[model samples]
Target chain A: MLEKNKLYTIWVYLQAEPLFWLTLTIGAFLVGDYLYKKSKLNPLVNPVAISILLVASILIATGISYERYFNGAKFIHFMLGPATVALAIPIYKQIHLIKKETTSIFISLIAGSLFAIFSTYFFAKLMKLDIEIIYSMMPRSVTAPIAMGISELIGGVPSLTAIITILTGIVGASFGTFALDILRVKDMTARGFAFGLASHGIGTARAMSRNETAGIFAALALGLSGVATSIIIPLLFKLINF
Target chain B: MLKSIFIIFLFQLIGESIQKYFELTIPGPVIGLILLLISLILTKSTKNIFITKTKEEITTTSNFIIGYLSLLFVPIGVGVVMHLSYLENNYIEVLGVIFFSTVLTIGFTALLMEIINNQFKKHARKK
Candidate 1:
């Protein structure tokens, strides 16, 4: 009986330790990665998506607040900055292709950025959602940090914006390839750009898994679209006074 | 691997400095990306010392980083739990807008890019 009590006390202490959630995150990703690999790289088996579902479920079941989980998980989040900077290497490698299509890339960036923002706004408005919801939805297609930044600047809820951005990523990462195929957008560069523009980092990851050229274009589009949207969304919002 | 990581973080730091100095709306890492690209281009053109080896190291290191890029986002994705009630209350609009707008954005962006790309190719051939 004493041993059982000691064990339980240790368990409770461990649960509150940041090391615990950190280990859980890495372990969950390992499992998710294993399943993803076993499934032959199916988009449906996306490791991030699976890991999120697993982590969220565990948090809910254990009654641990999301903040507690993030205490450890934030370490992983910090890596995103470096990872994003690393993307420049891939883009640099594909500079020739990007140079060749600079004009088209610019055009696509503008069109895609505006279309994503407006379509999100229009849809939210049509649904009669609140103005704040529309504002948060406006930056859904950009990466989370930029999206959240833009959402906050535009008077929206950053957490909600982050969630919406994740959902956009899941949707784009899952359905993007199929949609591109149906539309006969067979050029890998175009397909990758579309995916990244609509889904950001997650979509870029999906594209990176497929081909190097696709990954480069996806990164280019992802980086540029974020920059473009950050500048454009704020200006447009201020102009419209929304 | 360590060298590559140092280079990446250095660029990120530089980028953060520039972003803060300029008060730009874009993230620091993105600005770092641009700076890194420009430096890479300069290195390639100027025949700088150790350029080949540096490029090779960066390429190999970045490849590994990019391979598991999606995994880094898992933490943020899990942030969904922080806003469960908001999502639940607005589930209909949330899911519907995400589904419709994401699909529309993807389809529209791809179609437009294809059109523009074809036009560029045709114009380049003429030129």
Candidate 2:
């Protein structure tokens, strides 16, 4: 009984330890990465998904509130801002390859960004989904960080925005090439741009695996469309008053 | 690497300040991105040795940060999973909407892009 009591004390101490939760977050990712490799790098076996599940399960089992867990994990979350700003470096590197097509590229991407926003908006409304869900679905065509920000501003549930954004990435990555093939759009650059603009990082990953040109264009679209969507959605919201 | 990171943070700070004052709807980091891009462009041909060293550091540090980006989202990803029940009723609708819109957006962008590029090339030839 004395040994059991000592063990409980250690567990309680660890629960509140910021380093413990931080280590657990990283440790969960390591385990998730191992499983991802074991699964042959399958898309559905997403490391982020697996790690989120692992930590969420542990949190639930331990009955720890998310606020406490986040207290420890906030260090990791805080990097997102610096990392997002760092995005400009890569986009700058790719500037020369895209210099000639800059005009066309920018126009196509803006069209795609607006299309992504409004198409989801109208479809969700047509289905009679809740307005919050509609707003959530609207910004999901971008990456999670940007999408969640838009979700917050436009009255969407940020959590739902994150989940649905991942769904869009998975869907676009899985079927993006097939859909493009069907559309007779054989230009790899265009296809890559479509993948990034519509699906965000996951589709960008898929495009990267295909070839170099496709990968570059995919990356270009990912950052530019994110920036464009950020400006466009709010402006549109102000205009539409919804 | 540390200096590169500080530079990134510096731009983010500038961005946050400007965004707050202007009441911009854009994310501060995104605004920082534009500022960084413009700065990189402005310094593209500079002869300053210090600027040269900083540029290389920025590249490697930013790439390192980007490589582990998915790891950083783990917390929010976990938060979203907890709230899955809130979206449970609209799963089909959400999935359906995502599929069609993604497919449509891809097709529209690809087709229109090709057409615009071809037209641009022909116009250049005519000129």
Candidate 3:
């Protein structure tokens, strides 16, 4: 057995640095992503889910606080902006198709945004949920960064928005294709638009794997949905006094 | 490889500049995308770029990045750790809102698209 003095020294050193937590989070995520891909369960195997599990396990076992982990993990968070920017390349490729379907895309985005906002508010009221939780849930379908920002603006917890966003992605990835088929969405544009509006990036990924045309429309819808939701949700909230 | 990297950076730079100068609500990458689309349209007479070796390279690169895209959220997940108090307080409301809104959004968007597509088809038939 190790001596008590030596064990205490090691524990103190480990607790002092942020890199220890950062490495664990990223390493676990990469491993989880690889294993999930290899397992062939489904492309819907959300890496975010696996990463959350891994981190939660580590936190519980090691008695490390979340604040310590975030101290170093913030670097990875910075990449989200660049990644979103990179999405432009794919969207640029489908500009012509986007131009042709612009009207329909606009209409769908408006309808979708309204539905996302009102339905959540309505359901929260029915369920007797608190006002803050309703505010956080309002931006669940939007991308995480934007959702987090919106959550803050609406007096909800940004962290709750993040969790809600992940759940939305998982649900979108799992049910999106089936829903499309059940609804008999035959047109490639409509299918892509539906996926993007509903699931955001995960749904867009599903669309990209199917066909180029679908991929293009998915990108357009994803970008447009973000813009439309950002504008419409805020305005609607004010108008509705929620 | 070098050319693709250069083009991406150039577009990103242009996008960032536009966003900074104009205070547009649209993100920089989006503006860069519009620029690229304009360029592509103007050069439509040129041969398609996706036919050659470059297509293979791009597809491979994009696939690799897309595969791990979800992993990039770990940091954000970690950030959520800081918000546990808020989550504990608002869990029910949050879950309820997300579930109902997602279902409604999907249903409404799909219906709207169906209507628009039907209208377009009807117009085409009339023409």
The most accurate candidate by DockQ is 1
Model 2 C-alpha lDDT per residue in residues A102-128, reported as the tens digit of each score: 888989988899899889988888889
Off by over 4 Å in 1: B46-51, B123-127
- Misplaced by over 4 Å in model 3 are A1-27, A34-44, A152-159, A209-213, B1-64, B81-84, B122-127
Our model 1 lands, by Cα RMSD against the true structure, at 1.8
Q: Residue-wise lDDT of candidate 3 within A83-162, one digit each (tens)?
A: 55556556656667677667888788887777776777788788788777778888777776567767787788777777
Quickly count the clashes in candidate 1: 0
Model 2: lDDT of residue A218 = 79
In terms of lDDT, the poorest run of 10 residues in model 2 chain B is B75-84
Q: Rank the candidates by lDDT, best first.
A: 1, 2, 3
What shift in Å separates residue A118 of candidate 1 from its native position after superposition? Answer: 1.1
Residue range B49-110, candidate 2, lDDT tens digits: 99999999999998787767667777766776666677877878888999899989888988
**lDDT for A27 (candidate 1):** 90
Question: CAPRI band of model 1?
Answer: medium
Measured with C-alpha atoms, the lDDT of residue A71 in candidate 2 is 88
Give the range of the ten consecutive residues with the poorest summed lDDT in model 3 chain A. Answer: A78-87
For all predicted structures, in order, the TM-scores are 0.94, 0.84, 0.77
In model 3 chain B, the worst 10-residue window by lDDT is B51-60
CAPRI quality level assigned to candidate 2 from its DockQ score: medium
RMSD of each: 1.8, 3.3, 4.4
What is the lDDT of every predicted structure here?
Answer: 0.87, 0.83, 0.68
